[model samples]
Target: MQQLTVKEINTLVNGEVVGEYTGTITGLERIDKAGVGELTFIGNLKFSKKWDTSEASVAIVYEGIKIDPGAGKAFIKVKNPDLAMAQVLEVYLPDSPHFETDIHPTAVIDESARVGKGCRIGANTYVGKGVILGEGVTLYPNVSVFDHTSIGDHTTVWSGTVIRERSEIGKHCIFHANVSIGADGFGYRPSEQGLTKIPHIGHVVIGNHVEIGANSCVDRGKFSATVLGDGCKIDNLVQIGHNSVLGRFCIMAGNSGLAGSVTLGDGVVIGGSASIKDHTTIHSGATVGAGSGVMNDVGPGKTVVGYPACDSRDMLKQWVALRKLGKS
Candidate 1:
């Protein structure tokens, strides 16, 4: 454990120290929750009172924040404390954990497959026939890559992620534990006698810098590619249905589910547990708040929230009206 002084902390973060850098800060936390020997942060001016009462040894504050210097806490001022905190954690939680580049003794690699240079295939991991994995790829324990699947350079698939046959995933992507990509889409049709399954005949294409969170599922298309654009990020337990198109830098929060054929434009943000109905097109830069249910197409750069999600203004008005009615 590296015990960093206030001076060392400022050097590491390039932040201005309002008090003596002699006090030692052992670690970092949040302003509302940090204790002794730890450094925490206050994101905005509203939390100034909270900063005064926080028990942390040092507080990382954004510029233009004014608080009592004698509040028994040191101040570390930065242009962007959140970004600096991220860098601090990176230095603390370095990814130097041991991973042997050699194929594990128990790893199963197909004879016809091309496993690239400087790769690590963990125990019980299966690399199928005709799979072409690029350089610096890593498959954690129990990963299953099916036949003919192509994974690009510098990709990492965490434990228990299943990549189905023929799915093409781009470079620098992450599939967290228990993620299922290229699985058969949920396709069913009603018949006179009973329900019949629609055949899923297509693959999934995930672009670079995309991340699929733990327990999330991205289903394959019926006859074409179900795609996620570059730099898109999916949160844990998300369900992306078949043939859905997610644009660049889009974000889906935890437990959100998108139905089949949904098209999200660039930088679309959906909150936790939000459900977007099938085939809905959320335009570019739209933001959907947590637990929203979208049944229509959302216009670009608009913020939507609530069930059958409406525009943010309308939703707030409706909530206010509902509260008034409840009082009456």
Candidate 2:
């Protein structure tokens, strides 16, 4: 464990020290769990009462927030307590282990593949024909990159992840375990022979700083590319259908599914388990709440919720009415 004095932590977070107590903080924990020699944060007013009851030796609090003088803990007041705590965490957390810049013997790389200098290819990984991997790219054990795929610098494809043919991944992206990129789309046509599968000839394009979580799937387009814009974050078990385009900085939570051809503008937030119908558009700054089923276009900056999603306020009123009726 690393220990930092009150003055050292205050300088790190640019916070102002309040109170007379002096001690070194050895660890960071939640308000309810922090004990002696630990630092905790009070970010919400609801948790303010817990400050006095907590046994923590030090606390981080937002500017202008009042703390009981009797709490006995030293306080560091900052503009944003949550962000300050994160800065402190970075100082104490251990860095991830680095892998040697060498390809494992069990890995198979096609003769035509171009691997940049300093790349690390792990055991059982396969780099297919004509693939281009940029500098410092790391492919963990059991990872697969199919023909002609291009992955940019500093990207990491974790164990069991697969990047299919012609997929383009940008720099600093992370594809977690079991992620499937450029998979065939769920397209079919009725014919005399039965349901004929529509071949997906296109691929997936992920922009810089995007992160696709474990078990997530991003399908290839029918003719064009399925795109994830810069800084987008996709949570675990997400499904982005064929030709769907997510704009910059969009966030899709766990279990959220976007149907084929869906379009989301910049900064759109899709809550956990939300489902968007095919061809629908969610404009910039819109938010779709958890478990919502979107069927139509959501205007910019709108908030929608509930099954067959509507305005959030309307949904809340409906819930209130239902509860009153039940009471009667």
Best by lDDT: 2
Error of model 2, residue 146, in angstroms: 1.4
Model 1 CA lDDT for position 274? 96
Query: Candidate 1 lDDT, tens digit per residue, 1-328?
Result: 5677777777888988886445677777777788888888877887778866777878778977877545456788899988878867766564544766468899999999998898888999999999999999989989999999999998999999999999999999999999999999999899986999999999999999899999999999999989999999999999999999999999999999999999999999999999999999999999999999999999999999998899999999999999999999
Model 2 residue 195 lDDT score:
98
**Measured by TM-score, how close is model 2 to the native structure?**
0.92
lDDT of 2 at 119: 91
**lDDT value for model 2:** 0.93
| TM-scores, all models, native as reference | 0.92, 0.92
lDDT of each: 0.90, 0.93
Local error of candidate 1 at 219, Å? 0.4
